[model samples]
Target: MTLPTPMPDTPHTSAAPFASPSAAHAPTTLRAWVCHDYGGAEVLELQTRPGPTPGPRDVLVRVLAASVSSADVRIRTQNLPRGFGLLGRLAFGLARPRQPVLGTDVAGVVEAVGRDVQGFQPGDAVLGVAGVAMGCHAEYCVLPATKPLVHKPARLSFVEAASLPFGGLAALHFLNKAQVRAGERVLVIGASGAVGSAMVQLARHRGALVTGVCSAGNVALVLALGAHDVVDYTAQDFTQTAQRWDVIADTVGASSFATCLASLNEHGRYLSVAGSLMELLARPRGTRRSIGGPAPERVQDLQMLVDLARAGALQPVVDRTYPFTDLPAAHAYVETGRKRGAVVVVAWPEP
Candidate 1:
């Protein structure tokens, strides 16, 4: 349960000479799960393609593990949150996903770094988030060195490290926006999920009295994550309670400003990680504010999460892992909306 502390210096795992940016022009063939037309789990196909080449400022990673998240499901099925259907189509693709490969979180080895890149080199174990520019489902992923890429701690395996970025980054973004103060009451809906679980832990880390709302089966899990209280939504509606929180975060698209307005304190913030367009456009009734839309991708925020993970302040919650070949199965499980945390796909098992 405890990951080892990372050294201040970046860890090196291989000593081979890395290809220069110019040498990367001729890419080798690699296997990848590609989604040409989005419809169902069957849309993902494992196919052979030329490996991605790094640009002048890019870093090419040989993925060891990747996570299948709710975003992947949305991109796959076009089942977006309540009002963003047309917007999603425009951003993704009218016919299908603009990006054929769908993955966000990845833990891998730095196969090569661009000529102008620093702080990373060939053979460094690393974890990164590609965000909306999804491509981690492939054997090789190319990202800018300035993204959320960082050295993987020595103690955590590929699967464990792969679970951190997607959820942690989102939670950190919204929590920072909410400006949760110490000793304030914080309520996290969908607390058993990826973003929600990270929200609970990160809020607690910031010294808030965190309360988690989840199903009956996840009460113990949420409590173990350092929540001060747990509300089982299966048995009770959290909004119906007399209690009001300083910050209420809905991570599963379950609660809206109209529904949670009365439950919020005078100056409380309602964070909607999966909010619809109308909810995002809704005006504040009073002092209570609703914050929504996608969280911005920041390397600094990702670095903060890596530091917290190294200090044992953040713990990754991986509900299950599947072989790289079973990625379609992972997508199916995530679509069910029952996963406790990240669903990881191990491309290269740890030795």
Candidate 2:
């Protein structure tokens, strides 16, 4: 459960790029998971590719762990919100992925850095989301020096750190936007899921009265994550409960947005992850609003999670870890909609 601490000694940063890996470990090419076409996990094929070289402002990370998030699944299956399909195709690819790799969140060691890079070194241990330029499913990937990358918390493993960025950043963004504060009643649907789990912990840390809605099987998991109360959706409908909340976060879009909005107290916040076509039509135009958008990726936001982890307030839950070669299987597992927190794919060095 605990991860080794990175050496606190200030790194020797420079405008000049770090040199290539020593001859002992140097290799001209590497293996990576490439998504040639998008439909399902079967489309992700293992292929050989030229190794990546850091740009003038990039750091090449030797990925140790990469997590398959809801974003990855949606993008792969074209399960996007209405009117976003064309945008997705244009940004990603018409038939296959533009970058070909699927992972966005990763925890790894910096293998090299570019001339203009600073605040990191060739061997710094770090974690972050790669955003739109995602390619973390490979053994190596590049991250902008100014992106969400941050030092891995001392007590978090590569797998744990890898799991935090996408979910943590999302929950933090929506919860903060909702003006979460002390003593407010907060309810998180899909509370045992990636974003949902993070919301539960963050709301609790912010001194809110936290209630989580999950299946009966995951009731204990949500409660163990600091949710003050847990609702088993399989046994009862959370929206039908008599209690009202100051904030209702539908981390997963499965719940009816309108029904949730009606359940909030006057002037309460409704934070939906995205605009489901049905939700778009029912959106409020007044004080009782429904806000949904992409979760922003920023280094400062990712660092906040590290600070919380150090303070013992945030801990990323890892549901399962698969070998890098088993990414397709991992994807299949995630598609089943049964994972507790996150499903991670760990890299194995090539022979």
Candidate 3:
């Protein structure tokens, strides 16, 4: 679908004013989904909390929609590997969450922009990732203007735009690392899932022959997303297949390093969004290998995904959307590992 061209200079008056007395008197509060002490979906509770204020280089977005990701699930459960666990504990709070909000991807209207910000102004429709300080699950979030924030594609609804940042950037960054070329074969495991589905589309867009691996139910969906082939994981072993790919994107991390390596051709790249405990343990040793490299985490790569979405070359695959009050249910769905694409949390009432 083609997106409407964005008029960046056009002023939008539909957004609620952030400077209103109602907002100021209650500046210390807003409704948000908070994870007081992380565990399962049960940990997420809707509560009133202090709203975030934009810094000099930040934009305070009135979030319309936000998404639940596997990364959020990992952090919520404290299931990350040793280093990540320590980092999370320090960065986020040692006992409870420093940033209790659990969302990363967001699509929203700019309610306010910091004094030094220039590129975006109040009322701009935008989508991007909000890293460690994840307050997107609330009514508002403050993100650095210099981060990946970009104009939202007019073709996508807020719910759809909310699904892109994390998975899209991960796919784009991994593909760039893989250096995929036209006619090269690309295999995306967990293709029906968020990151996997994104990788499939992106690899195809790069003119690579893309094969998507998913359950039988999602084969058509994967194929519709531009995959050249779809492998039903329930019916067969993709790693043992005769095909050798130039790049293998293992989104779920269900496949081991050995299995990924085995499926690759010479000088082929193996990429994954979710890292296993084993991979983290072996990182030091594998860092020097040609087959294994450091994981992708470039902010510029996120901008590239934003551009792709705006250009209509990328589209977020949303599995389901829950109201702001249903955050626990959304978290539960993410934990199940059966969601076809992204699980979005709509933060505000629709127009």
lDDT of each: 0.84, 0.80, 0.73
Which order, best to worst by TM-score? 1, 2, 3
Candidate number achieving the greatest TM-score relative to the actual structure: 1
lDDT of 1 by residue, 237-303 (tens): 9888899999999999898989999999999999988988888887877798899878888888888
Better of 2 and 3 by TM-score: 2
Which pairs of residues collide in candidate 2? 15-115
After superposition of all CA atoms, the RMSD between model 3 and the true structure is 5.2
Question: What is the C-alpha lDDT profile of model 2 across 1-351, one tens digit per residue?
Answer: 222222221122212333554322333677888888889889889988887756788878778889987788877887787767888899888887887887899888877777687787777788878987889998888888767888776577787788888888999999989899999999999898888988999999999999999998888789889999988888888777788988989888876567776678888888887667556456664557777778888888899988897788987877887788888888888888787788787756455
Candidate 2 residue-wise lDDT at 222: 90
> What would the per-residue lDDT of candidate 3 be over residues 1-351, giving only the tens digit for each residue?
212221111122234444532212224557888888978888888777766665777777778888888778877887764346777688677887777787877888887777777777676778877766577788887788656687776766777777887678777767877688999998888998888888888999999999999999989889988998888999999877778887777788777556666677776766755655455444312322123233454556766776787787887777777777778888888888888778887745432
lDDT of 2: 0.80
Better structure of 2 and 3 per lDDT? 2
| 1 against 2, candidate with superior lDDT | 1
- Which scores greater on TM-score, model 1 or model 3? 1
